[model samples]
Target: MEQDLWSVEFTSLADAIRSGRVTSTELTELMLARIAAFDGRLHSYIAVAPDLARAAARAADAEIAQGHWRGPLHGVPMAVKDVFYTKDIRTGFGSSIYDDFEAPYESTATARLRAAGAVMLGKLTATEGVYAGYHPSITEPVNPFGDEHWTGNSSSGSGVAVTSGLAYGTLGTDTGGSIRLPSACCGLTGIKPTWGRVSRHGVFPLAESLDHVGPMARSARDAAALLGAIAGADPDDPTAASVPVHDYLAQIDAGIAGVTIGIDRDFIAAKATPEVAASIETVIPILEQLGARFVPATFPETREILYGWHTECSVEAALAHRATFPGRRAEYGERLSALLDHGAQVTAFELAEAQRARRAFNGAVAAMFAPIDLFLVPALPVAGPTLAHMATLGPDPDGILAVGPFNAPFDICGYPTITVPCGANGAGIPIAFQLAGKPFSEALLCRAAHAWQGVTDWHRRRPEL
Candidate 1:
């Protein structure tokens, strides 16, 4: 309404259009102009669907004119990770393998978002297949928090777009923390919804069992609005849950007066870095003030999770691209290429064993949640690594643990995990807290997250860059 469109949350933008303060066309043009002016340096988008977006915006404005606003996303502009099969638009998986591949059909997610009256800005760049960590050859988007720092991979470019104001929100796939990793690194709010809660029909996969498509946004409310638009059962994906969608934004505002939060003493005292430990610990007291309860807990089967996830991820990935990897081994970078080879070598016996272990772990995890409404951990024990280092060799453990082990287990467990910036370290890099929950518990997580956000300004803070 005030024309501070870039800074306004999706909720406010919807209110503006609903009140006749701004038109969808106006916001669409603002985004396009910003993209033209800024994306040359950020490299956030692989493609800009200008004509298509304008048409959608105009259609939305006409709907508003006809007294038929769809909802919160009615005039909001959003983007997707480039790996989605966006009809008539170049939907590359940040790989040279299918660089020219364009889809004749729309993905269920894309089509639904359009039906909800959301406008598409374009396709954001991602790591190869939007799967693994760090793909520099396809795009070189800098993290919006700081140009000097590296954006987290896979959804790296999508993170840049949101933080830099190139787009309001974008869909990102999280296999092992792609969405939460970048959201944490860029100081945004992100949710990796419970597996099967969101559709993956037209999107590319990193791991079939682990991959989750969700929203990354400047605010939790914005994410909830986007989530509402894109979530639901899809006929295209047999795995899509038959659960009915609820008003996520309204749920978030309901607060966490009675939520039971579990803080694992071992994980907090063990795997966390000083920053991560500090960030997560701070959340307990804050949420307590909001009337959320804290319980100390542990996982008896924690030992089996990491190894099983590694075996499962590599194996699934290898099977997915078995034909391509052996023939085009030379095209891939070092880490992923090697992982693919090893994935192919994983025996069926080993996979079966992993599945058995996973069931045991899931049962233990479910038992853990039985005493608590949500579980809290440091999203990753460490902050983002230097792309130069991760690209050349791999991750270097500093003062932090290889904390990514948490992300994989949730994917295997098919539960929901949301990560939000708690605060930044002394160096100004963001630190995140992860909230894990039982299946289809996104509403509970969002409600709690909204309450936490109300007390903290971390979500509202922006980078000087």
Candidate 2:
């Protein structure tokens, strides 16, 4: 195995372990060391379970030596956002209220990954209750690309860990752009699988209807491997879709020949900054060269989606935190506290109207996808906004709305969307675009993204540590 194991792609690491080129213990130790050396500055982890990871790695090695390889993830070390329940490990939902709390059982996603023979590295950092900001006591993960850039929302740690090579891959939950935002900002590939596509049984909720659990990785194929391990129906979660899971990597190299990718040039131009818009424009010619077809597809009316997303997310979040919120309001952060307060005050009629609008938007999106296999857009309006800029947008409704146009609509529709690194700005911060598909179209998204990655080296570029 190479000495620079941290920079290797997830699939390559798994292959090395499977072929006896490296042992799980070796990989685990290297990752643990890297986390120790780098995480102090990055703050990408909430807790690291080195003992547990070693035990799991040893077991995996013993099994593989006996010719019992479980699958692609066998003996591979990975981590999850702290919101997922990990038995015997502190599962802080990034809140001071749960500072000393540990889960009695494991989340379905973690259990499934363990069952697939993957080694658990530890828990990654998450925003307070997976909301807009970190709890007062928690340190926000810094963007590895530049300390000044915003790390995105709740899944910032997941993005930081993978981009910084602290973990091979990670799980990130998306409600409104949590996964895609960080992936875009950090220059990683992320999948926001359709709602219910992955079981969320033991994961803390931001918004029940809007929340989605998915994988963040350096490449699309790596994401497919992670997604395959944790996806499918779970008896513990009735909301987990009963649909049969697709072998995401089976057709990953099939090429995008003749695949219709809908492009609303005006839509992207109107919503994106010049840097972002130009970067997205460059991606079209590359995809076209790979035999993909593009058509001028108009985006659906989206002004209502921003407001509906706020209403629906607020109400559901209020329900999720009902047991401890008002009683322990002081323990919460300002952003989450305000969210809960607004949610508490929303009248039934307002929530109902929000739902109505969401449904109409979903229908419009479905109709728009009827003629195209995928819809293309910038992952965020700006290439990469600075933390200073994001701070000002905290209380500005218009500013808040500016960033949601490319993100919230898909969450509202429960559609599958993937973000791939397309280009970068002058300062070398990442710029990316999104490809969204109809529900359960994750395989298509992965295939398209993988094809893009194969032809470009944008995803392979790393930040200097």
Instruction: Using TM-score, give the best candidate's number.
Output: 2
lDDT of 1 by residue, 243-325 (tens): 99888977787888888888776766676566667667778888999999888878554556677777787788887777688
**Worst lDDT 10-window in candidate 1:** 392-401
Error of 1 at 13 (Å): 1.2
Give candidate 2 misplaced runs (Cα > 4 Å): 1-3, 396-399
In order of listing, the candidates' clash counts read 0, 0
Q: Residue 427 in model 2: shift from native, Å?
A: 1.2
Residue 150 CA displacement from its true place in model 2, Å: 1.1
CA lDDT, every model vs. true structure? 0.79, 0.89
The clash number for model 2 is 0
| Positional deviation of residue 175's Cα in model 1 after best superposition, in angstroms | 1.0
lDDT of 1 at 196: 90
